[model samples]
Target: MAPQLDTQTLGLVFQSRPDILAGIQQAADTPARTTLFNDIASFVYERLACADAPDGPASKRRRLDIAQPPAQTHRNGHAQDSVPPAGSQTGALGADAAVADPVLLEVKDISVTAPQRKKYDLCFTKNFLYARASGTSVPVQGIVYPWTDIEHAFYLPVPDKSQAQYNYVLLPRGSFLPTAKQASASAVDRQQPLEPLVFTVPATAPKPGSIGGSSAKTAEAVSDTYSSLFNWALTTSLRSAGNHSCQLVAADPKLFHSVARQPHRPNEKAVHVKAFRGSKDGFLFFLPTGILWAFKKPLLFLPLDRIVAVSYTNVLRTTFNMVVELDTEGSSDGSSTVEKEVEFGMIDQGDYQGIDDTYVRRHGLADRSMAEQRKAKRELVENAKKAPADGEGDASAAGGADGMTELERAQQEAEQRLQDEEDEMEEDYDPGSDGDSEGEGESSEDEDDDDDEDEEDEDEMGTAED
Candidate 1:
């Protein structure tokens, strides 16, 4: 007789699978990997736990949304004060007591939308730490006390059906804005993949209109189409806010502070960079891209001095080390050449320089295909169908109050978060992304907007904002 597997065991047995990892190899396969794996794990667990006997029929199971990341539960219970009676001592304290510093810890992970279907669900690796408890004084070792399990992945859930673009989800090669390299996918392509979660792809590539001197595809690119092409390509991928914000680089988190010194342009993308306020300095995370950020809109007036750190949550949701250094001398241009000398780029957790051909083959445009995609999508649906019959727990380990013991599984989720963020940060920084605020001076987003927009595009921006 076989030992029966329970939901816990089911989750445990297949805990190591990730979309990217599963595609790697079978020897690397874990339990509940395929519909078959989960089916087997489910059957085994059922046989063991069946109330009647080992011979009893197994019960039905359901698919769990592995993508749902554990909610952030701040370990430090900072006291929340209510609005006191007008002019009361309580009111004064609330106003003056240097409001409970909402510290920001930089995570190298970024979150981005897949361009279609998934909300900002990407993740990438970062060298930073997630403290079970808050405080920059001590180094973040690992999960502590109540947080026996550390969640490596996080998803920024965008409002369903909302017009806002949750630029944090990740789409495969032909996904959302699959670069010019990847086969460009359009909206009408219903075969277009949908994330396990719901999301929509941007309808078309934003066409930026005109610019005078440097040749880019300004709507009025005189006769220099090729030069315009080259410039447009860079502008579409690079952030103008001191190009340093999105390049691939590395640095010590403890050293840099304030986006001001680095002075991030509003519409710029963090790019291949993982940024976060180090655990040490208190930070103000300008997480205003979502509904909360749109409404609260704090970055505009928040005490700039109080912001000691900042980072990005891009499409893949990976955390990267974002080191923004401010120079009294000032950066010469917002382009990558000049920007890189400052904060630098986001280096991959793996051997970065060694990331040669092998790396490109794995992640580059070649990775996508119609047949491969169909096969992968079919398998996912199949697994989803059998999920309930198997009674499988979440193969993805999520640390909610539950006693989640699968650290390896948790790591898988974390990886997704990291990778997603990386891709998103970079895409957002594309010079022609048109992400900046309207006429608000030099911001990464604003610069990208100016680079890409034709006189006609400005009207679109206003409409899009609504």
Candidate 2:
């Protein structure tokens, strides 16, 4: 089963990063994180474990079996099964949190200098859905000090009405602090900060490898690779000439961060995303290994507006693709209001090698060399029955003469397959065609005609008697 990292926890983790990492180091050095602070350590270690699990999930564990033919069962006249959105099973997470899975949060480009020197990645998921962070203010001595532990105040946005952006996120300072009470009501009560400090990753200069989606030059570059990668991942047999969706290529730590709404850590790039253009609610997901780009089918098209969550994982250390989801549904004034909707995730190797194959073919030198192996096996089996007592070049005998070799096994399988096809052909009973069932239907039609003739004769006799 896949490990479901609570995005709620991730959001908190994102807010408390640099400090959280610092705290973890301190705890490790002094064993400060005792029983009470285990959750923080759990979050960190589990992340490390996921990264180390190689040959585990994303290492092309099983050869893609979907490439096999689809089987049609006899009891399949009923419609195909559908996933019940209302009653679907989730890993016991909060409903609201699951639905808003950071679909558009980019670690916007890092800044390098003074007016632009501050470096911060803009991390947001969906605009309609808000990402929250609560800053905790722990009372250490006389004054209240912000714990900046992931449990700080919930970072809700303070709407800047004029600017259409929230000016500040309110902090309910009293909730987490210790309070005092007395019989005469003379004891002091702890109060949270009236105004919690609003720490914005100040809009600084874009860092060396960050990307910005606002600029035309930048948007084109970001989509150029990200879109291509997505398209290749969704590569299907329905591929037609000049009929292709804009492929999403993975970003390679360049101009992408400049515009990313969320900048991720060097360690946490083990996630990927898929957008189904045709889904009703709009998207579905697989863990890091579950999404294979080579498995292209209409079953995967996601609607642009319906993406609810993006849980990325670098299950293996080899994570690729830097990118964001863009909301291209432009607004009025003939100008775009929401210029860029960005979030970042990583794709693993099983997905990459598979995706890479299709791309190479498109550019011209792709090879699917297994056809020769299959052909040789077929010829070897055909010759095996005629070989001498001392088996020589028979494909099956060549494979292994030990009573049952792969070549002989394959021949048996092929014979059975042929027999099954013949049975299917014999079973073809066209209900309305010239079969026994159709003959029975024709007999009923003749009986109806005879009855009609008798009725006409009776009417004529009655008229003559009158």
| Local distance difference test, candidate 2 | 0.28
Candidate 2 structure quality by residue, lDDT tens digits, 1-466: 2222222233323333556645543554322333223444334423432332333564222111110111111012121222123111121112222222332323343221211123333322221112121121111111111122111211111111222111111121222111122222222221112222222322223244433223324333333343231222122211221213322222222211111122333332222233222222221222111121111122121222322222222222333332223333432112222224222234332343333322223233323223453333322222222445564454433443545644456668699999999999988965557656645546777899999999999999999999
Residue 374 local lDDT, model 2: 32
Clashes of each: 108, 73
In model 1, which runs have C-alpha deviations exceeding 4 angstroms? 1-210, 214-277, 280-466
Worst lDDT 10-window in candidate 2:
66-75
The reply for model 2, stretches above 4 Å from the true place, is 1-349, 352-359, 374-420, 429-466
lDDT of 1 by residue, 332-399 (tens): 21111121111212323221211212222222212121244222221111111123444554442122
TM-score of 1: 0.14
TM-score of each: 0.14, 0.16
Clashes of 2: 73
RMSD of each: 37.8, 31.3
How much lDDT does each candidate structure score?
0.25, 0.28
